[model samples]
Target: MTEENLNTSGNPSIQDVVEQRLSRRGMLRMGVGTAGAAVLGSLSLAACGGGGDDVAAAPAPAPSTTPISLNFPAVAKSTADLVTVPAGYTATVLYALGDPLNAATPDYRNDGTDTNFETRAGDHHDGIDYFGLNAAGTARDVAGSERGILVMNHEALTDQFLHAAGVTANPRPAAEADKEIPAHGVSCVEVRKVNGRFVYQRESQYNRRITPNTPIEMRGPVRGNALLRTKYSPAGTDTRGTINNCGSSVTPWGTFLTGEENWSGYFARSATDDTARGGATAKSVVSLARYGRPQNSASRHGWETAGAADLYARWNISQTGTSTDGTDDYRNEMNTYGYMVEVDAYAPAAAARKRTALGRFAHEMGMFGLAQAGKPLAVYMGDDSRGEYIYKFVSTASWDAADASPANRMAAGDKYLDAGRLYAARFNADGSGQWIELTIANTTIANFANYRFADQADVLVNARLAADAVGATKMDRPEWAAVHPVTGEVYVTLTNNSNRKIEASGSGQQSVDAANPRAYTDAPTAATAPGNVNGHIIRFRETGNEPAATTFAWDVYLFGAEAGMDATRVNLSALTADNDLSSPDGIWFSRKTGLVFVQTDDGAYTDVTNCMMLIGKPGQVGDGAVQALEYTKADGSKLTVNARVGAKPTSATLRRFLVGPKDCEITGITETPDGKAIFVNIQHPGETIAKANIGDATKFLSHWPGNAGYGAGGALARPRSATIVITRNDGGLIGTDGTQVLNGY
Candidate 1:
């Protein structure tokens, strides 16, 4: 979420594995069902608002088997301050930041005067999932295409725009902190198709906001552990709120899993805190440094400096009280974060649970694999940092079809998510990869020299260390992932990495590896952005078509490059003007049409166009041959990497769908059951406004939807993060002719 690269781990880079050149390999067995979308199969679950045990369940319509193809013309790339879709499609604003959810709440006055964000729409909408509602709008209806509930994560904020004249300096005012803290969690809003368009319900009973002040239970092996003890919860059984919620996942039983990312920056540590905790060699001290919270680090929002109230004081991780067990101070407050928080949207009164068995480390997206009738479930995740590793957690209990529409969804999460085996990925030069288990029983982790493991709880709480001990392959900022609906192969987006170097720039700098094979800068805006200026997407198929497989085959699915880049080197995917993109961040596959959507959060290619989203038809892994790319090192040495890449993309296969306004990122998209409409979130428009010029709208980078006539119009409107619904004029399926799907693969 933060543009700054915070990874200091000197683990072996993907370039290290490419140099081996062991041997070529075959593709793994892909699954028969879908990952996130259609894996629910024929089972249908009601939307939120249905009582826990009274919700009705139905079956969904079968997916279309028509061949995949792009039906509409591609929209030309634009730098204009509005969402640009194809000619036949219409984009309508559905929900915006600070929009009131209750009838008692006043309408949003977008000029930074809004309050009680706990009852309003949060900022920076990220990953989202659509839960369909019945025609009556009271319960979930997997078959209901006209209405549903959208559960989305509010990742972070553009603080400069939160107040009337930007944020106060140093010792921040509690008033400013009060509004920002509640805007950083997740929101659940009910939306319906009204008179041929989708609009959010202002007074739906299912609507709720899960802020940092909400009550959440700590579940799994790490619950009640001493490391989680703090003044707020001496028993360590519960914690207050979830912060920096990023990308999300929807379970087969209809629960939402929100990832906690970039949370380490919110805790302020005193310069002498390491000494207070018994020296730098202490286990707690080592963990603090490893998680990027070294001594003297300042809090991100200065919430800790806003008086001594527990709400503000909890942000400070300094040991101030006299108690030795951290029961009297907030020393262990940071430990309560960074895990996946599961929310039952159907049950508004239920407390969200932090599932710790999944492990914690700047989690980006927790993607589920194909859910079978009686097989173990698997969740794939990325750490979302420079030189971080990909991980997967396989549940110990096998899946039961009855749990698909359980009376109590959180109870089902307890059965599957509470106990699991976590594994880190290691890519081989020969196009093969292995998933190394991260458990206390593993000799490599149990006898790690860097940090000794006390038990399974310690291994999971400090998962990065266990991953490092096993020599996992470091990637280029892996963010969001998507699994194919038919083929079942997993695709992960490796967003650009500025820390990547042709030759080592410093002790922890990463070099070009086989997996991350590019280290070139683009002309114009990205001239200074060397080392994979435009990121790429890599996909792999699990061995034996099983989510719990330990071995798999992988290849670069698509390379993120400019249309004019060198084809033999940087433009490895053979991209054209219509399909070229940069820094692929959010990704998802349409269960109805089998089309994968790619969104960007980039600074590398902004000179030519604003960030955009693209739609494409994906092919299976190992569909292309391995290519050799040569690069010159800093010392005048030549380096060659044999990168296994997938099939080339064409105008027919991949094309830009929508381009966002200035200084904003195109993120979080989901479609209706019939694929007739798609909801997209536009985040942080005009975010480049300087702190001194916050109240001056003329100096704002972009006016966005407001200037385009959605909310408060005119030249003085402040840009607000909002959601838009896209639908075809002819009432056809999105990106396709209603009766037929895309014509190309």
Candidate 2:
């Protein structure tokens, strides 16, 4: 959006406000606006209709060898039908909600019969990555290998179905709630493709799970800080489990990094307890409060009352002790989470460590760029909260191919994550942006009146506070981010935020700005609260066209809106039924295929159709900039989005490839290096199934991957979360020359 317009009031549009506040250095960081040109150098669309030269140059040929296509328009009638792909392509249920993590433990009953889940796969699986296999059944990086270790992030539990029955009324029983706590973590399983079918090798030594009770070491600046000390780990040396594991990434060395998000609400802290634990002065309070934790409020699942054991006691964030001398039971234990955790996927039994060096906030996911030897590695992240900032981490040490050894895995992390400076971005009105370093040694951030920092640990523990001190521009809830494989430009999803408005006062009041410009009321739905329900995607290129550069150029790549909405503003590209979407959440750009996968997690338009994923061949950066957005504030004042228009994708160019079942989110995408096969995760299908009928497949909302009739004829077909495989029946490169077979024959 451009920054030229404002209403009667003198207040500048959000774009102008952010531009005025951006440092000159930050503008220079955006490659002085030339980064966009560098990214579009290859795709020349105007000369060959809407398709690129590559498609135009290729000769028209016979149909693909493996006529790949979707098996059905909507395989899932509800949440209970088994989803299938075209014949010759197969689908398998690898893991489901509450599937035990350790084979040493009992297998999942699947008939609403799961009880103990400390060792099982958690619910709501999200982002995932595939690691190739070695000859000796070990994890490796083979470009053409068909077998590998799969690392998946279990974002959170659909507690309504995890227990024997759903959550009881308020002040619920402790044992019932405790059953749901363990089902929220990360799962690593060994998988292989056999004769065109994928199966999980349960007996593989690399198959393991890490839950909330698992013992994990803390690494980086905040490791041993006094604020982190808890009764269970007196020295702040170890913590148990990780929750809210969202989008994740795989390091060049083969380790998996699961992001802990919305982790602050898991504990219960009394008002009196807040004061005893250093009160507001303690970084714990500021950290806890900023992360959405409310004092004296217990989590929806009550694990604190499970028992006197350390497992249950750790969930209590109350200050029960008398002093700060390690005796004052600082219930601030919950603050220790919400950081990026490193899991050794190849060694499933190994404990996952929380990499505090990455800086803690509401992390949605971490995306790593292609690693090059002797070059610094870069990671892009989004804080999944309205008005939060986007961040990136550059490893201090150069990459070395030799560091792939098991012993050197953590060492690689130390070199990259532990020492790098964290940064927040500020987009300028002139189409450029700057990455402001969020370090402690120098800057206005260090003198923040809210929290005092003695070292980098303080800076990380109170990252939001520090960012606020420096006046980093806030954005709509930022979700997943990906770096363009061919262009090296970075794209981020600004998921809808109801709280953002055009006014400066009142709850959820956010002035209309360039980065997050829309503010409109949406029909109320179970998935999202009304206002500003649909979202948009933003893309930028770094200064010097370098991934590690501090400055960059940016623009709104696409806006999410219905076809009937104002095409000039809301529907920037005039997206039609073939490509329109809302609340863009999960996004990925494939390097091998040059195709972008866009998945939606939305509530505003659920009534229209199920959530879907769109496949697109993007044109270039800065294709859809709008100089204004008409947003009326709570007061009488008006607001507008002042963004520089960039090339926008038309409906013909971006089409919906698939739609999920009822109450399900289409997430976790990865593909073979050759781009011949694609994998996607269908999470929490039939989630709306009533608690009373959880065990009955007939009445349940979904029975995916399990044929519908089979579950009704006295067949005990259990609904399970699964990974689906999609490959062309005539086996050919996907999306090549726009002639790839689609919509199953």
Candidate 3:
């Protein structure tokens, strides 16, 4: 759903029920937090400095793990309508929206007249993963990032650049949406570095596209459950392609795990379906409502009005079933999505499989925690919607280094991803946190009054409901999470929330807490936002620094802000022009270099600067102390939280790396193993431009890729989402540790 209308603070209909059970689950949280904190406290105490952060109103200090320091001159702020880089770096546009993936397809015309989307690249590129594929089109045994198959997700579409006159209105046209269908999935292409620059290899054997029309199989706990039965897949064992593929992660076994985000906006429902059964089906209505698809929800493009066959009819998730079991209609079609689908880059012809045991929600990514020999494995996931929960899945099987060498990666995923226990994070007011198990075995879950769960599969299918029963801590739009390569610290980005303290009477929305502390505004766009606008990065370490530990210690690492902002007014980082940023959404850590890569997707600070990417040194926990943050609550109450704060970022530690063109988001950052070449994605440039006035080419909001100094020579007609490669002009490792600017990796 679009940010303008999405219910970011969660479903109001279920808020009261969730709040009533939060107190009941307090004992579990304390028990878990105590043990986790004890383990983290000992391991981190000696590594971190004493409480010595001198910033005023900062969180109380704890022992911090010392991070490798940085030493590059910061880049300057700009609204230059192009990508801006430091003196030694060069940016090259690799592959872009509508660029043909095969030689048989014609080049993009750039005026929306292009067709046969299945043979061309899709729009709105987001998360990406690179699998080192050998010249024979097989997986490379080592981490050979220089030559690999790059798999990236096509998140969404800008109808104006897709259809000749933009998406149709009222009695929507099927032909317009026919072209849109194949534009919303994943893209697999072969790329290699030659003379220090990375380029996509057109027409390579690894080139493939998985669109919404492709076939996919179902696996794990809910594979054949009753809730997944539909007219197209009555057996509930298979389905068609994954849509709204956003931020994804790579499994240790070498497969692309794409997440389905904002999928609730794609299904249509009847206006009277909620009252059709006279409240007998009220439970079904609640499930749909929690997912943001209630009665009469018309869908983002009205794809259901196209036709009546299963091809189009399945888009409508209405309960117009002819049988009592719901097998004769498309009522349960929504359950088919909201899963992490795995695609094998080496085997392009293989069907993608949905790993349902990971649980269903507005999934953003599923990053695996640190993997060690003979240790239990875990993967961290975030539900991107505001006021949602962060989840972790622990595998039933222990880790074996040999599993990573499997010839069939998809088969290896079965031994790990298909069977696991999902846990939801509950961050406490203190400096500790807990990962509550979300199984039906819990008494509160087994006796949940809102929905009746029959078994573990039922609980997994309705993971959101299970989370609500256990009272997980509501967060502020959790987007992407990353594990520190050297420190074993976990970082999650809370990409701002506008509904932090604003609540309806009798509603159960959360107020500002230590875990999600700030509430600021974007006066240029939104007059007042009740939660963190320039979002902060929260980091934690597991008990005994083990990835599978249920307890952990957490603290806010950095709070985003603009230049010259008042420190008293919540510019908590004391930011300068070089290191200031907003809405830190995408993050990555290189174990080899011990550097953190940060990217932005901002609506708050666009007036000051376009979205950009920044680099910083990842430091230890307890480097700083408890901070005293002062702000105004929704009820006009003066509030101050004794929140934990970490080491501050100075000009030498955190610096801007690249700034995208107008209206684009800097997302999806990755690098070669040697750390010489880096790849970043620029998504949906000119997105905020009104579609009606786009016919006037001169009035088009942006002329990017072409305008952004991409000299490859494509038609300079409209702005397109594209992937760009960055390399040091001197052929040195890009932004190495302090005092190594001239050294090769």
Which candidate leads the pack in lDDT? Answer: 1
Which structure among the candidates has the greatest TM-score?
A: 1
Give each prediction's root-mean-square deviation over alpha carbons. 5.9, 8.5, 8.9
- Tens-place lDDT per residue, model 2, 484-574, is 5445567898877665565655443456677766666556542343345588888887765555788887888777877677765567657
Q: Write down the lDDT of every candidate, Cα atoms only.
A: 0.81, 0.63, 0.73
- Order of candidate numbers by lDDT, starting with the best: 1, 3, 2
Better of 1 and 3 by TM-score: 1
Candidates 1 and 2, the one with greater lDDT: 1
The TM-score of predicted model 1 comes to: 0.93
Ranking the candidates on TM-score from highest down gives: 1, 3, 2
Per residue, candidate 1 scores C-alpha lDDT tens digits across 559-593 of 99888989998889898889899999998877656
Q: Evaluate model 2: give its TM-score.
A: 0.84
Worst 10 residues of 3 by lDDT: 48-57
Alpha-carbon TM-score of each model against the true structure: 0.93, 0.84, 0.89
Model 3 RMSD in Å is 8.9
Output the better candidate (1/3) by lDDT: 1
